[model samples]
Target: MIKRLCFWLRADRLGPDIPITHLMLYFPALMRMICSKRFNGFGEGSEFRPGAYADNCSSITIGKNVAVRPGTMLFAEKGDGVPGRIIIEDDVLLGPGIHFYCPNHSYKDASRPIPEQGYFYKGDIVVRRGAWIGAKSVILSGVEIGEHAVVGAGSIVTKSVEPFTVVAGNPARLIKRLR
Candidate 1:
């Protein structure tokens, strides 16, 4: 049993017999390298297991022990001369398929065409220390999730999350306080 566990943890030895998901589950080192090189441009420590994506902003500061799962997309806008930055502080866990946007459209201008509406607004994303963003959540631009907070799965976080609170659902509402 121990030998089998060891083999799974080593990505180099992992082969076609094991599915990609299984490999990521066991080999954290492989994920770390991928994130550091492929995603986020530059990442630090064992916190992130990365992927392919664009990160041009220096605002994307990540803290130690921050684990961002597979299929997570982080982006800054082209409209904002400077790419919007994201700061994920220490011990934060971002689940799979989590999408974060640092920009938004100006839909308030009803007279403008949809395509033209693209030229609207952009914002920064800040995930404070010890926060947990559940699977498949969409964190909009300019939203700050406070320390030790929990965001529920499939939640669309549009506003700032309070510290030590649990929020869920679209446009995320407060579910309860974390004890």
Candidate 2:
């Protein structure tokens, strides 16, 4: 009953296709409450800044003290009736314009257009505890960003990053390994 009411209120206030859903970024308590009700698992003190977009909130799990900056997009691909999961562990810091894609499209058939080929589920994306993903970084499917790892700004993470390491550049090469 309350869930339906909240949904109706949101739909009425924000309309159907607003780019930014939650408007109260400055109000942490309200934001936390709203996100906790929507997401799969939203831990305490986790905040989603204004303009953060989640394609399917039910597939995204946010941990405690995680800060997702504005313009971050969390997209969980739905395949075989199961949506891809994005698990962001505790104390992670996500910069603006960060993108996490849990599934990729199949383009094996050259004859068909890329869009026509359709998509496939790669796997869940896990950002381990204390990891920091920099601004505009793109994290591809089936990648596990290890604990305390730092992904540099504008990097494209194609593979699993090692724990306590710093990665940068296109394809995200390991720049340094922290203690």
C-alpha RMSD by candidate, in order: 8.9, 3.8
Model 2 over residues 1-179: C-alpha lDDT tens digits? 77776564453122124433555555777677667766888888788777777766777899999877777888876453458888999999898999988868788999999888778866889999999999999999899999999999999999999999999999999999998
At residue 161, candidate 2 shows an lDDT of 98
**Best model number under TM-score:** 2
Clashes of 2: 0
- Give me the overall lDDT of model 2: 0.81
- Candidate 1 lDDT, 49-113, residue by residue in tens: 33423344244666777665666776655354556677787788888888888877667778877
Regions more than 4 Å wrong, model 2: 1-22, 79-81
lDDT of 1: 0.69
Best prediction by lDDT: 2
